[model samples]
Target: MELAVDAKPTYEVGARKWLITITVITCAIMELIDTSIVNVAIRQISGNLGATVEETAWVITAYAISNIVIIPLTGFLGDVFGRKNYFTASVILFTVASFMCGFSGSIWTLVAWRFVQGIGGGALLATAQTVLVETFPPEELDKANGIFGAGIVMGPTLGPVLGGYLTDNYSWSWIFYVNIPVGIIAAILSWKFIKGGKKKLSGKIDYWGILALIAGVGSLQMVLEEGERKDWFSSNFIIFFFILAITGIILFIVRELTTKNPVIDLRVLRNRNVAVGSALRFAFGIAIYCSVFLYPVFVQSFLGWNATRTGLLILPSAFLTGMLMGVNGALIKKGISPRILLIFGFGMVITFAYILYRLATPAAGEWEFLWPQLVRGLGFGFIFVPAASLTLAGLKGKDIGQASGLSNMLQLLGGSVGIAALNTYITRRIAAHHADLMSNLSLYSQTSNERMQGIMLQLQANGKTGEQARQMAMGIMNGSLSTQSSILAYSEGFMMIGIICAIILPLVFLAKIKKGEIADIGGAH
Candidate 1:
């Protein structure tokens, strides 16, 4: 249990370091779970608040956009305000916003509070890693990263399960309300025990970079979230924002590269491992994030499962993933090649996706998802921890903050993009399938005629007129057709995710990380 004599100490060593770790990890998990917890409650929110699905989506979109805008700014803000002060302040803001979000009577009111919550939430995510790396000795940073990766995987994995149980058993507001007590305890611990560090604040503010970042990231998020709603590029709304995304991104890059004090240092990507690791991270984001989003919606919408069942279906896999984090951490400490783990993880990911694709159906029960999801759980366990260690292995000091910010920001952006794109794909696929199925439905078709006749007779026997019975029968038929189309679309979507993940397999071998270099990082302190 003893650290080496010459190890660097950012705070008091031993007991306090572990306490600080627990405090920040608790807050980080709270913030992260909030990102996806509301997903299962969208229906309850819209019904209670009288908001349409489109209007209610803003609840999710607003939070996502805010996270994108604020994440990269965290390093800069931490330097201006002491890290502990900024971190403690963020916990207060997030907790208060959570309290307010639970009580909002209107959809827009909830959206506004969620946006504020995301601002605080984004800070916790960006700064918590910095604290972890600083808390442990340099060689033990991989162990720190293993612990940090647990929160990342667990938060999103458990969010829907917790959200579903709360929504079905209590009310949707409980999702937000649940954060209040936990947030208060975390804030108190973080403030009282965690040490604060202040940076020498002398750099000129990069206002242009800040502005460009806001415009670029904000516009890009808006485009992805709203593209399907507006019919994509066909709408003038989509076209205008596309221009802003491109122009703003260009300007942001130019400003950051030229500025004396950049808000986020883009130059970090020039490193070989950092650059390749980022792309793989982004791909990892799309794979895990998109599958989680798609699988739940598929079961809920087509299979007639309640929120609770849908959430529970994936619970085992997530827990398996969390348990594996420690397992991988042990492996990393043993100097096992991260490349081998990553390749194995990616292989499992491909396997998980393909299995899900093969097994997905309108009638899939919880048992059907059990094994595939477990494979996914194992796959993520290998993928997340090692991918993170490899990407961050080369960074030191201030660059760690900037790299962490950039890596975290890209993953968030990647998740949002994946959700948006997959949703759009499902929408289009459903429409096409629906049209194709409709073309085959006819009174002259024997199977269609008998099914319609049986439905019509049942409705008539229940006291409907002939015309009413006919209308009801058609309604039933159309509903069934829509469900079938949606189920097929989701299956294809899962297969597509598998293919995309498989394409990234080559990156595992190409990774610049050597086993010895990463091993030194673990014991170097």
Candidate 2:
């Protein structure tokens, strides 16, 4: 069955176009916010449900597993059902799941609801992007990208802030409850404004491909999200998932390439721009998500900042990134090479990382981080629009949906890899630094003795006996050493991200993308 490609593609105009843009972008933001919003409430969630922190982490992991599993399938699903119906149904599903999540009495119940929410959330994100691209005419695609990019950058950043505010003032459940109103509005608007195309498939649905996708992507996502927690491959649980991920992914690729009607068209990668763009998007995901993950944890865990303060610290940079997205789009529209913008983006990211690396110390203040974060904002702003434009550039018809899904999948998977790898790296580095520091802490050395004496004297001055003071001095010294080790480990992690960006920087030139090419809506070909 076919939807004839010879027919003219229509785009929304005037207030209708903008309204459609707002509706899709809003849905995308709501999905993204929920991705990270639950993070800040983990402690509260654990306590309220009488679950260990480790058990409650499934609340996050379950959602992530379902999200990645569903993301790449959205394009295929959209084609099977009309895009409008699929998009609106996803919004309703997400809203209902969110409501159920708030009412969950146990950890596993909440996890189940979160998983369902992620299914809808993932569809919302991928379909929303496709909607935005199709809603604008080819010439104004850059502008559509700007609006969509703003939401992309703003969503995860806003999650923690919004979640922190609600959880602190109200309850942990409010984080899920908050999505109800936004999802309702988005669903209504989507149904009212979005157009649906009648699509008829010629063959049976790709049942094997769908199952393989779930096993492959779902298991892989679980590995990334839960690997460090499960102690990597040492844990049999991780090893089992790791095996499943490899086997499932292999079957998935083999089946997709051979199937008459693939769930996701792996053939999209045959296009050079899509291939290269997907790779760069992976790096982009790493840069953005890891920074968001690293900064908040650093401030709140080590710097002793509260949730609100940590979230606020990230606010300015996020806003700056949002503002710059439009400028990047305009520049692209004016015929600036996306490669140039891409390169500039990477350079700024490296600079931001370098600055933060230099400034990572136990005594570093909010002001020091503020400046580098602003530079990061500049990096993200420049990167977001250009990378997206380049990736989907020159694709038309069904390829657009396929490419969008693949690119989004790669980016999300990249974030998972970056976070998991960096978390493991930092943990190992802390132990190494602790050992190195401990080696120099010779009790026989004059410097060590002086330090010990000073600590003991301070303890005594605070009204302690010599024996008690000596033991207290040891504890204080150990704590100080641990803090310094952590600081060093974190500094190196920043550089690791910078090096990743630097490595991916050269791939920008490999793509055969034209200087000013923007994606054509379906039927343009």
| Lowest lDDT block of 10, candidate 2 | 1-10
- Alpha-carbon local distance difference test for all models: 0.83, 0.88
Residues 331-413 of candidate 2 have per-residue lDDT tens digits of 98888899999999899999999998999776789998898999999999998789889888888787888888898888888
User: How far is 163's C-alpha from truth in model 1 (Å)?
Assistant: 1.8
Off by over 4 Å in 1: 1-12, 453-470, 518-525
Q: What is the alpha-carbon lDDT for the whole of candidate 2?
A: 0.88
Reference-based TM-score of each model: 0.93, 0.97
Candidate 1: tens digits of C-alpha lDDT, residues 1-525: 111223444434778888888988888888888988999999899999999999998998888888889988998887778788999999999999999999999999999999999999999988898778767766676778878888887888788989999999999999999999988988998899866555555666778899999999999988988898889999999899989999999999998888877888899888777777777778788887898888888887777888788888888888888889878878987898788888888888889888888889866788778899999889888887787788778665566677778888888887888888888888899999999999767967999999999999999999999999999999999999988888889998998788878887788777787664542222211
Candidate 2 Cα errors over 4 Å, as ranges: 1-6
